[model samples]
Target: MNAITKDVEMEQQREDRRVEMAQAKDKEDARERERRWQESHQPRDNLAPRWREVAGRDNWVGMLDPFDPLLRAELIRYGEFAQACYDAFDFDPYSRYCGGCKYSRRSFFQSLDMANAGYEVTRYLYATSNVKLPNFSRRSKRNNAWSDSANWIGYIAVSDDATTVLLGRRDIVVCWRGTVTQLEFIADIVNFNQPIYAEGIPTPDRSVKVAAGFVNLYTDKDTNCRFSKYSARDQLLAEVRRQVLRYAEERGEEVSISITGHSLGGALATLSAYDLAEEREVPVTVYSFAGPRLGNEPFKERFEEILGLKSLRVVNVHDAVPKVPGLIINENVPEFVRRAGAAMPWSYCHVGVKLALDHKRSPFLKDTAEASCFHNLEAYLHLLDG
Candidate 1:
């Protein structure tokens, strides 16, 4: 072979080795998860009476420190729902439905072999990708196939009769898909806050604002794509309103909304939870992992104090994501110090309880320099399992 051909062959060999190693890692992860699942056995219990508290009504008081078994189990359960979005997404760019869900909504859980999830997919959520943001799954969209204007972001699932009885209340879940292999979304964040009114979230407080990039994704519309004709925010709100009417208002059932996501999805969860709580009387709670701070001081105040949003953020202390956007001016700064930039758009704050975990303490996870592994959803579940 010529010198150029020889170099190409060597590069192919290295790439093959990397793929092989990644496959091995996947197998090891699966085995580890199976082992952990076998060890942690939480028996099924009728949680109907305490469902609100389980969903964080009292802000998870007395349930986080010792990592209450029921609460931990519920968190894991919700995490799996978020994980389902990633699993069901059609990541193959060559597939005709590249940006849409791989399975029909009716068969979503069944196709994923998650028949035990006990929730039915009510609506598939879609969003028009911002021109500035990187499209992680499909770099180059093919025309006349999947609409370039849209991508399936996640889905909303409601607990069935069996699940509702087991969990103690009718639960409405919104699971926004985050990333595992693709981390381009993180590098693309604009690191600025915009007024919440831009997204049509009716807050009288002028100071309340959110990350410009996240709000754009939640509120942007694409009339060309059938899936995203309405913004993700509108789709979510309409369906939630419908579900509440059919199950709660009409049926006389106790209903609760639990929003869960990891990484970017977590920011959306927090944003949507605030929007929903602002519109209705039902209890709303957020379970997010490795999510970045999404809003400013006034936004946090309105989200938690006024809306009574119950958020449980489970993050690796080592992950860079949770400590960003407002790295210098966030809530951690002394109150007087934060007030220095309270008038600025960059002064952000996290709103809710934090469940911090250290990956270094884990014996299984590799001690890596990159934050993606630490920011991984499976990694969060593994750490939470311990």
Candidate 2:
């Protein structure tokens, strides 16, 4: 009888231990989900005041009013036309809108260059070397293997000499695409290459994950995309920030960061700008092309609070993506019509296309591509004559 009682007691104890372990695991998973949710959504505190203040300033609207009504109408119409060209490109990596179309390597490069045409032209006007180049065909390294399914992120280095000495040999253009696992590897690589900066308002707690890109996204949730891969943005940003700091210190240069991306990457860039500003007070600029909305009205307002006007610029080359910050105001409109707003009218409007076309008539395109473009020498010389 004694032996039988002991065996029963041992069995009961084992069952209780199993239940405890399961409960602990459940708690852990719940906490992780909560953390991820916070990361994916924009934080209300960051958006409220600054964004609302800037949008309400009327400075931009006032500037527009000086032009003729016909011009205003044309601007709107031209915006729509430019948008159509982007739509024709068929570059839908994030949204489900381009269901039937597929991206050929040739088409992808062509569309990319066209999209950048305006930038190239602007570079020429400023006498700066055109960073714009035609989308040349390079054999994609397993590009399509990840095409159907695989998370990817790209980083474009913009550390041109114009950026100042503080930023060193970092690539101005960097892009990466991959799943969570791939993101982790990329983050680790960035961490290895760059020194990390942990300074920022309201630092992350141990329970919270710390990253530059995702951290801002998590804060600016309302006006940004809630894609699953977005969670990695912060981690990747943390890595980049670390690198930026290392480069700045090594070169004895003041820290300045600028970020840009298209679509999902654009949304991440916006988040990154806010995070960098909040933490280091470092001057930064974010140029997002066709990024999706991250949050609600409240979040938009808060975004301005955290990221001031100088620190951020979200540009939609037409309404190619859905309604996002500083783009088409009408959210209820159909996606197709809304997207049509992306097109611009001037012959030299598209960034890459304009550059490619301009190259045919003059050596300016080739010179600008090599980064030798700068403010016009003739104009300066003419000023001396006076």
Candidate 3:
């Protein structure tokens, strides 16, 4: 009731009000900073006109040296598309859906929390199992297994109308799943060459040979698996043809095919690109990550000079997979030496422009990480971002 006590209480109330206002102002400043950061990082829009350059039609030209922000964003985006295949795949042998996609085509993106991916899954691709089950995939040995004959290899997805408008083309994506470890991938390399024409591939040159292991992976067929009596190659060509007919020819839309993969899947992507684009009018570009040498010198020349494919292969210098299948006799040697070794079973050559990145340069990763860490698709994506 005293005047002095009332005055003290009033001053304390005013001090409390000032403290609260200061805290609120600090919180508002933090939120404003976050908004600005996010706005700066969003990918640039209206890529429709420059999509050809982004797709490497000009061999990526000036865009690659300084590493264009749009190009970097697009590369990471497609790399994530390849990573999506691994995320949506059913890997556990105990589950009945093992060696298959975990979700249907309609709900594939949604199931992976990628509802805003802006691509529609049109078809699911399957391939007869080739590599051993011990290291990579494990098919159920129980009587109630899903399919012992085949595995869900990858998928075919097309950009939606809204995305197409922004991309300047109806982009058809062929993404393949790759093995996690390099040791598992190494087990499947046969190091032998087979003429692609022998397999009824659409190519005029009979001498265009590729690794027998890859050719078998593409051409092999099994009937017991669902929606896959046709070989992976057959399924791919058929589906791409259908998409091109509907979009490019019928609908009068600009279209392009982008094939992506990692490790074994990358090798298959290269093979599929050649088969899909050779002697055809489709504009196909490959975004391969951590892929090995795909084929012989003739095979490379046939696809690039003759068929015209723009391939951008992203690789880590520390990764060992890119150096094999042609260590002794590869494109690095002299012309006469390469010609002399071209007929050998072990001779191999890579296709298209290589975008080499280094793992040591990444500050987040440890310098002593295992070999698998270096070859991981996610790791490749991180490097691409830098």
Best by lDDT: 1
Candidate 3 clashes between residue pairs 3 or more apart in a chain or in different chains: 48-168
- Please write out the lDDT profile of model 3 over residues 1-386, one tens digit for every residue: 59999999999999989999999999999898655333232224757777888888889888878888778878887888889888988878788888788898999988976777788999888877554434446576567877877788899999998878778889899998877678565646545788888877877777788887778878878776664588989889889999999999999998899999988888889999998887468789999999988788888888788888889989899998887778888878887887888878888888898888998988866776688788888888877765
**Candidate 3: global Cα-lDDT?**
0.82
As for lDDT, the candidate ahead, 1 or 2, is: 1
Whose TM-score is greatest here? 3
Q: Can you write out model 2's per-residue Cα lDDT over 164-234, one digit (the tens) per residue? A: 22122232222221111111222221111100123233423211122233333233211132222333434
Q: What are the C-alpha RMSDs, in order, of all predicted structures? A: 9.4, 27.4, 4.7
Clashes found in each candidate (C-alpha, N, C closer than 3 A):
1, 75, 1
Could you tell which candidate, 1 or 3, scores higher by lDDT? 1
Cα TM-score of candidate 2: 0.34
Model 2 lDDT, full chain set: 0.32
Residue 117, candidate 2: Cα error in Å is 15
lDDT of each: 0.82, 0.32, 0.82
lDDT value, candidate 1, whole model: 0.82
- Could you tell me every candidate's TM-score relative to the true structure? 0.87, 0.34, 0.88
